[model samples]
Target: MLNHSAGIRPQTRQRVLDAITELGYRPNQAARALVTSRSQVIGVLVATRAAAYGVQKMVYEIEDAAGDAGYRVAIATCLSDDVSVRDAVDRLVAQAVEALVVVGPQAGVFNRLTAHPLAIPFVMVASDRHDDLSVSFDQVEGARIATRHLIELGHTRILHLAGPVGWVEADARMRGYLAELADHGLAPRPVIRCEWTADSGYRAACEVLGTTDVTAVFCSNDQTALGLLHALHESGRRVPQDVSVIGFDDVPDSAHYRPPLTTIRQDFAVAGQRAVGMLLAQLRAAPPPPADPVRPRLVVRDSTAPPG
Candidate 1:
């Protein structure tokens, strides 16, 4: 009766339930798992360096969705290196997680998992699409949207402030910017690489301002844009007048920047829900649905305008 198993009369079950409620009885999950052989746990692996706003939002959404489905989520953090990735996986597997979600942005995590496959179902949340199970927003398209917006505003000498070299998101955004420029027959400028930080962006902007004479800059992320805006302000260059700026990832604080930023908004919540749904379908042996990447939209703000 306590387990809600069938074959128990309603009156007897009600009496037992009333007594249990009066006694404040609780069931032990460990013992239940032993008898039922279902851990009802989903494991998530996130790289310590990749825990940005978007990734954090996705993790929270995944946890909420899993709870609604009667499953608990266990999260583990690891470095991007192979050894750390392996150790994190071991810890999660020890918890008897039925499924896994990999949120690390580095290529090493994928390489390690490919070399040694897990028996359980797993999904990767990445910027680039893979042949295996994965979910991502259309990074390339998002960049194109940002660049196209600048081009449509009549800015031709557009520069790109790229993210760290070799990062999947950085590479994708760069590709999108290049492709859009090529489509427009505009010559590409040299990319200034920087880490995904305001300080890096500030330094890069300070250095590049001496030689580069571009009318607009497309930043890899909003934080980079914020730094660039600060640098431009300090240098007495007005935004959307001397140089227009656009950025990716319409983070919450972007709108509050000195001059509100124009950016691309990624639907992290949708991606999280879809990832969890895919894993549940795999566990049930059901046919996995189409693996379409999430679409991103452009958000126009005060930071971009026609070249002066």
Candidate 2:
């Protein structure tokens, strides 16, 4: 019998551990759960069908962090409109997850989740509501930085290609863009609200062609910027020669864009780890440590320059 309370000889303990290792012995999770009244599992609900770079990277880090904390992760994915947030939570709760982590910018998630309250603690990722246990890269600040860069490059007539409505991140980024322009005493130009896709961006840019006298454009995301670039190219407007373009969430392929993208770099891994850490604290009945929103940096590239 291996007695943990009674001090066993070190040699004996080592031999027992070696034998367990050699036999590939594993602990009985069911028995442990019975004793502790916990499933030792964390549920992650992501509101995206096609995971983008930031979402994909953050999920990876969250899984690693949860593993380090001696818990398993169960993931549930739902579309923005196809599946309701309540349905996703019900699925996770059915699995007996000890805690929950919701990821993405769907603002309606808050009210929906509040309506169907769960006994388990839940944390949010990449949300504008900081009053709760949430982790996010400051979207507004990143937008401000991107917009300010274009401003400093001598482009006063700047246009913002905004993200879809009802997204917390989209609202924050738009707020940042407005604030930056106000600080510089630049008049707010037309804000083209579009979907977060290259196609939408291209279409939006086309609409701006004959209507606006914009010299620079800040897209909500890298994909949108890519489309904007395509539109400019097709319209015989040389990038940085005719107009400067900037984007947010420096995705992996941003660096390889025709002109390489000038965008904001988010530390998704760090944010992921933080969100997981908060979940772990709840599991242990420990107070969560104070965490600040992750700061984003500007990556200067060929896509932006002083306006001609």
- Per-residue lDDT over 37-120 for candidate 1, one digit per residue giving the tens place of the 0 to 100 score: 999999998865657888999999999989999999999998877788889999999999999988866655677787888988
> Roughly what TM-score does model 1 have, to 2 decimal places?
0.95
**Residue 240's lDDT in candidate 2:** 78
Worst 10 residues of 1 by lDDT: 124-133
Candidate maximizing lDDT: 1
User: What is the C-alpha local distance difference test score of candidate 2?
Assistant: 0.87
Model 1 scores a C-alpha lDDT of 0.88
Which runs of model 1 end up more than 4 angstroms from their true locations? Answer: 7-25
CA RMSD per model (angstroms): 1.7, 2.7
Candidate 1 Cα deviation (angstroms), residue 252: 1.0
